[model samples]
Target: MNWPQSFIKPKYLSLTYLLSLFLTLFFLSCEINYDGDERLLVTGRILNENNLPIPNQDVEFWIYKGSGAGGDDDLISLTATDNNGQFLMLIPSPNNEDGFELKISDPDTIYQHKILHRILDKNFTNYEYNIGDIVLYQHHVITNAYITFNKTTVNTSLMDVKFKGDADYLVWINEPETYYGDYEPTLAHDYYKNVPLNSTLTITYTIRDNSTETLSTHEATVTINNENLEYIINY
Candidate 1:
């Protein structure tokens, strides 16, 4: 006669034991964050006068000085506006017993705007303000617009270039309107994928708007093997 299966229990509660271990760990972790109030954080948002979100605008806060330390030029914390012109910034309490101030800056401007100035109370946190729609004025002058290459060479090869400008424009080969073709969005962010490298290479630029033409063209000639390669017409 065979002993019944239940007559002898398994030496180990393998499955049951493993499950209990896992559950214990999970419950322990839950106890840590169970309060849900530990994350008590100070938060705020920024909006335009029209109650619109201003994206990419920088906001800063600084410590205040009552002794006419107005020229204390250092930023404690900075937060940028989001696409909706809204910002959620976090500010830590000051280490010393000093006053505090707040300032906002427009990314497009040469210098940022000083939005607010005041002394901070001991109980300072969770600040909010509606800066309104900030007018982004043009700061880049087109007169100095042009392409720059690493080095003009005699070898017939292509080289990548870093193009920096205010807008996504085109680089013409010869005159503003003349070129191999219009190459753009040109390296996306301040970079060109492939640029031609020749002994005598000349390049110009054209604005996005075809109606307005460039005032002048900028050209760079490559010195290959200590020889000059001229491509211009002879009189």
Candidate 2:
């Protein structure tokens, strides 16, 4: 008198349909990153250049405003490393923010603050994300070395002055070459570079004499320290 269970499939088909719907929604959510409720459990360890754990190191999570935002970065969360130099953060992924930055500050202020940025596309679906280990270095005390290029002759010549030093070595042209009215690189590219304490720099100048149509090279080496801050090169 009753319809067979196989023939009456509405109840069974509805259950299957609901299950499929749930799975589809779950995957769809994962595909769309930066969901409102999405969050990350971040973990990392802080160490010094000497391979020693840095305890009490500040850890700040920030939602970096992309270029042209014209606003300050939004702070997400702030914490510090434990005694063992380990840190963990439960931070949210904002739907509006396009980038994230982690600021690791040294509590003692000896080391320069580290900025970790350019992290945007990540698996927000994952329960945890580990940033691994970070190393901090103490701020290097730098001494500025001023340079002056003295031309030996008023005749026009091709002079190329080059310098080699650490990354901090910089050449800042505060005054344009028009100040000296010379087209030579010695006057045009003449600038000072910051030399860290106990750092050395090599200064080389290549001169192309227009009168003789020949080239001459000269080299000089100098070390910068607390006692020796001035490095003057003459051409």
The candidate maximizing TM-score is 2
- The local distance difference test score of each candidate is 0.39, 0.64
**Inter-residue clash pairs, candidate 2:** none
Candidate 1 per-residue lDDT, tens place, 98-144, comes to 44455567776642244444444523434433333443222231112
**TM-score for each candidate, following the candidate numbering:** 0.31, 0.45
Residue pair clashes in candidate 1:
48-132, 49-132, 53-84, 53-85, 54-85, 55-82, 64-99, 64-100, 187-191
Residue-wise lDDT of candidate 2 within 74-97, one digit each (tens)?
677899999889999987666655
Candidate 2 positional error at 1, Å: 76
Q: After superposition, how far is residue 89 of candidate 1 from its true place, in Å?
A: 3.2
Say which candidate scores most in lDDT. 2
lDDT of 2 at 34: 53
